[model samples]
Target chain A: MDVQVYRVPMQRLIQGNGMPQESDHGVAIVGMGIVCSIGDNIVEFKESLKKGVSGITRLADRKGPKLSVDIGAEIKAFSFLDRLYRYSDIPETLLQKARHCAQRSPFAIQASVLSALEAWQDSGMVARENDPERLGVIVAGESTTQNYRYGLHAGFETDPEYLSPRYALQFLDTHQVGVLSEILTIKGEGFVVGGASASGNVGIIKAVQLIQAGIVDTCLVAGVVADLSPIELQGFVNVGAMVRGNEFQTPEQASRPFDEQHAGFVFGQASACVILQSCDVATERNATVRSTILGAAMNLDAVSTTAPSASGEARAMNEALRRGGVCASGVDYLNAHGSSSPLGDATEVEAIKQVFGDHVSKLRVNSTKGLTGHCLYSAGVVELIASVLQMEGEFIHPNKNLENPIDHKLRFSGARFEKARIALAMSNSFGFGGINSSIVFQNAC
Target chain B: MEKENIFSVVKEAIADVLPDVDTEAVSIEQNLKSLGANSIDRTEIVMSSMEKLGIKLPLVSFGGVENIEEMVDILVDA
Candidate 1:
């Protein structure tokens, strides 16, 4: 018998980041499903990328102040309700439409179901109803549109005098997970994460921990956001987050990350889900292994609610790499949280310099938000999907609107796809409350 | 107002909110809740309908309508 140990490097190590040690967990991603402005599924999304086609478009009859960048990466043809009923063998019109509801019931339920079903099918895992407790579901969502808006409309139309109670009770955010669990028949460990932009990464990280700790054999991690209501839209506008622009010209050019003339971010809705299991379990089950979750770290800025500290971001990246048993040199590319905002982009660049130091010069960095227009809660998983695709295809997707490298030390893939065998890729996602998350994926050969 | 004008206004509002619903099936007597118009959606419909009709009803007035027909009655009375 031979004992073989794989030693991953640690060139620039940082201490006490509260990250789990590499020995404590071994999580692997067997399957992924993504629905975004790029495509409805992974295959279509890949095809669109190969053809250099973008899913961005100008919204029709949109009401707002005219913006210089009015383009968005939106999935227009996807009907959650139609697809759900079609695929699930559930008949349409079976679910009655509640009175005065803004959204259809079937549509809302289908959003989660479609993504989850795709992940399950991709993983080649069959749902065993007999042992339902083995399957766990953790969904991340920003809004409870289905439950809240529906109840509000029903109450206002049926009885206006008792409106406050209905609005308060029905709009509870937990309904997103409840509805999803009911539809999927997932019986174990149901939770919902709602930490602004970090929700997707947070959900997936938690799911990985659960499976790694022997709590669940399989976990369904999903992030979703439905239509942006006027109230929500106005709120973003008030915070100076939404970029009101008409000159986005084309959808592909709308989100210009790391560009000198870049404006704010556009709100986009999407859902991305992945199936995670131990590598041993996946091999036994004959799952199509996509990538490995080598290491993940989550931290808070501890500075402000809205602004993230560069030190915090650096600590997160360093800690994630340490947990993954990799070094700064081992990291091949970075899928950045580049929201196209001036301060956010600069802060991330400084963090990369602080963490990676000299190796930052060798790091290939690109932000998929340039293509997807920041899907908010779904952004992290969607970007992770892009990273996995890059790893599988042995290529780094280009950052569309980056005309000039903001930091010469950082290597920008620069507007065209580049061929590279990425052994380790990292993704960073930071949210409004200084919630920062960094996840590293290794090419599982 | 002519019945045709009322139907057109209601149809447009419905189309905006519930684009998937069959326009031909919609009528004054149809149960709005059963048809999938929940309270928030109905409010949007009402708001859009009022915009089209150029009529403004007090927010308190919407309390009386139980379904689409009752909503139509309120509109007719207004």
Candidate 2:
């Protein structure tokens, strides 16, 4: 039997004026939060970036078989209750709810909740009465529960009957959506999206679309931490995607982005959140617009391999600039997806050159991964926050270990920070499986 | 296992699941629902109690149980 595959016309009817309407007040970032190896909040993160603090270190004791790679930027001395109390201004009831929901949850979930709460407070959403039904949430990351499930293996293997019933709900990635929506009282659309390392940028782009489509007035996008288990660590090492820290004298010097000594990415863990809303809604509520998201775009190489394509990346950047109604020359700074992987860094540099042309000589490029390590899933959000902080402070952070320039034509921040005026910026994030994404931001403050 | 001992184990399980609850004041006559142990928490407490007592029983064995005393009776019998 012959199976007929239906085909549709490539060109459809032209719609109305294909332009941003008046009601489209643009997506503006109103609040941001982060928990990473370098800092616990945005303020500390900014200071760390200014001083060039590296969070990479020898691996802590993980309850599993010893792996070949033993270095990463792990969050240290984390206590859920203690971290919750840091937000002193949060209402007692909300704090209590956070505790009740995440006290017994996994480290990944707990970290996400902390970041989300901080963003919520920073956005002043609690004080300003928001229609619960008009808010949305997006969780960005896949396989975030590997470490949590790895911890439960021994007990389950010996006595399967004793497994906690909550495992059913906690293992899925969308569990973040449930916890965040409940805590923030967000009743609108809620779901999880994953694009490996590009997950954070994908989440931000989705939130922008939701607000622009009038489906939701506001959205909270949480980038989940990649809590890799021993198996994952060994897998990365075997695949030659992660550095083993043997060549470096110290762990801090291992992550050298855009340098001749660059090898592979060093693992890092972080959870970050950003509150995105329409500019009109922010204006109506008198909210402080931290940064305006002028444009966001995501593309793929249509391949499943981890290798990156410069053309795909350049396409994403060009589309983002086009949607933003800005030319390549208009971008002043670029928050590079410099994961410290030699291939990844080289590919991104090539893409930047393709998109910016001669303007590449003027664009100040630096990778936050040099200080924070490659935060895997949360790298996009972490770099986004870093870009915004640099924009707000009018300073470009130092590239921790770019001793020998990989590309001399481009302007790369050296071992020390530099003063720069960055009114417009483009942040890039490319994930495994050919996912490429870029977001353009204009300093609103 | 005696019912009294089983009750003590059940109290500890409740305390582990619901830290805010005062296990000392908990009477066997009071049910887990009244103590703020949601359905999932109640199942966890039951499984934990059974594990501590080195016993295994079908989850449905406690389906008809109404109070801590009744659940303790099942564990004691096992």
Q: Considering just chain B, what TM-score does every model have?
A: 0.82, 0.96
Poorest 10 consecutive residues by lDDT, candidate 2 chain A? A1-10
Model 1 C-alpha lDDT versus the unseen true structure? 0.71
Task: Tell me how far the alpha carbon of residue B10 in candidate 2 is from the true structure, in angstroms, after superposition.
Answer: 1.3
lDDT of 1 by residue, A153-187 (tens): 64478545434323443365555566656555578
Mark the regions of model 2 whose C-alpha exceeds 4 Å error after superposition: A1-25
B15 Cα displacement, candidate 1 (Å): 19
How does model 1 score by TM-score? 0.75
Backbone clashes for every candidate come to 23, 0
Error of 2 at A26 (Å): 2.3
Error of 1 at A164 (Å): 14
| lDDT by residue for model 2 (B1-78), tens | 477888999999998889889999999999999999899999999999999999999999999999888899899889
Report the lDDT tens digits of candidate 2 across residue range A151-230: 99999999999999999999999999999998889999999999899999999999998887778889999999889999
Q: What is the C-alpha RMSD of each candidate to the true structure, in Å?
A: 7.9, 6.7
